[model samples]
Target: MTGRKLFKSAKFQEVNTAVKKDGAAIFVDKEGQENLIIDNPYAIRYIHSYAEDTPFFLGLADGKLRGTKCGACNYVFATPRGNCQFCGETTKWVDLPLRGKVHTWTTCHFGGEAFLKETPYNLAMIEFEGANSVLLARLKDCKEEEIYVGMPVEARFSPQPQFSITDIWFVPAGAGPGQRSKK
Candidate 1:
């Protein structure tokens, strides 16, 4: 109440871009008053353990999509899981087909730091042939207007695996339409 304005702007440009260079970002509030926000850059390194999901990440490295199946209920997961949701049984790693249809999709206008550079990208939930669920991934090589439910897509993996989910994505396989998912 004593400092910054209570209202915001469309782009929230508190001040002109040329105002300063000491890690201060400018913003113009709704009242047309310039405001300055401090900005800083930092980085860190940490060890990671895939644990039970090691197979899934490793599968991506091998150009494969690995999902877990409940041996007791036969329920298939598009994303690997350690335990089954329906039967509470241990799941087994299984290979999933690379090609699938887009079950649902959205065009992202905003994203986190990792995807900020690729804002306005398409994301899709792909439905595989035998999987009961869908895999969520970035849809590449296509425009937002070109995306639709049931659109055919195929898995694409990074040539150099980073052992992360970003290692996998999907690209347009062909142009065709299928029925949209109800739910």
Candidate 2:
């Protein structure tokens, strides 16, 4: 059976809870089964909250790109650090343009156990406008043959109704912005 189908089985979501936290509702499964945890610091830092600056997810919801700029040294950070990496000063929030270019990318044939049974997906590192750092997000709306280094792209959000929050995804802008394909 496919990983998606296996995950969709009744056994997987049996003890799931739709709990709200910090204005965002999330699905909490208590069945003691292995599942994807996207927000874990060891996995990926989804928000800038680890440092107190605005997170990229929030910026995507508001239709903007947000970053942290050092108030003391005027240094801009892409991961939105709380303090300047260079000067160790408090970082200020800054809004960035939605436009960006693909810096690097890879197609994943195998992910966690859940995705192991499914087809491959693409992940990309995108460098946004006015920022010296790159952001990592899932890439959508284009085939593998069409993706290239330095390709222009934009950020898009998919609403997760169960959680009442939006998940950010990226796609090629020239092909058509905001287009997503089913996994």
Candidate no. 1 TM-score: 0.73
Off by over 4 Å in 1: 1-43, 175-183
**Candidate 1 lDDT, 49-159, residue by residue in tens:** 999999999999998899999999999999889999898999999999989999999999998988787787788999999999989998887888888998999887887
Point to the candidate with the largest lDDT. Answer: 1
Report every candidate's CA lDDT.
0.80, 0.64
**Winning candidate number (TM-score):** 1
**Per-prediction tally of clashes:** 5, 0
Off by over 4 Å in 2: 1-55, 114-119, 161-166
Q: By summed lDDT, which 10 consecutive residues of candidate 2 come out lowest? A: 15-24
Worst 10 residues of 1 by lDDT: 174-183
Judge candidate 1 against the unseen true structure and give its global Cα lDDT, from 0 to 1: 0.80
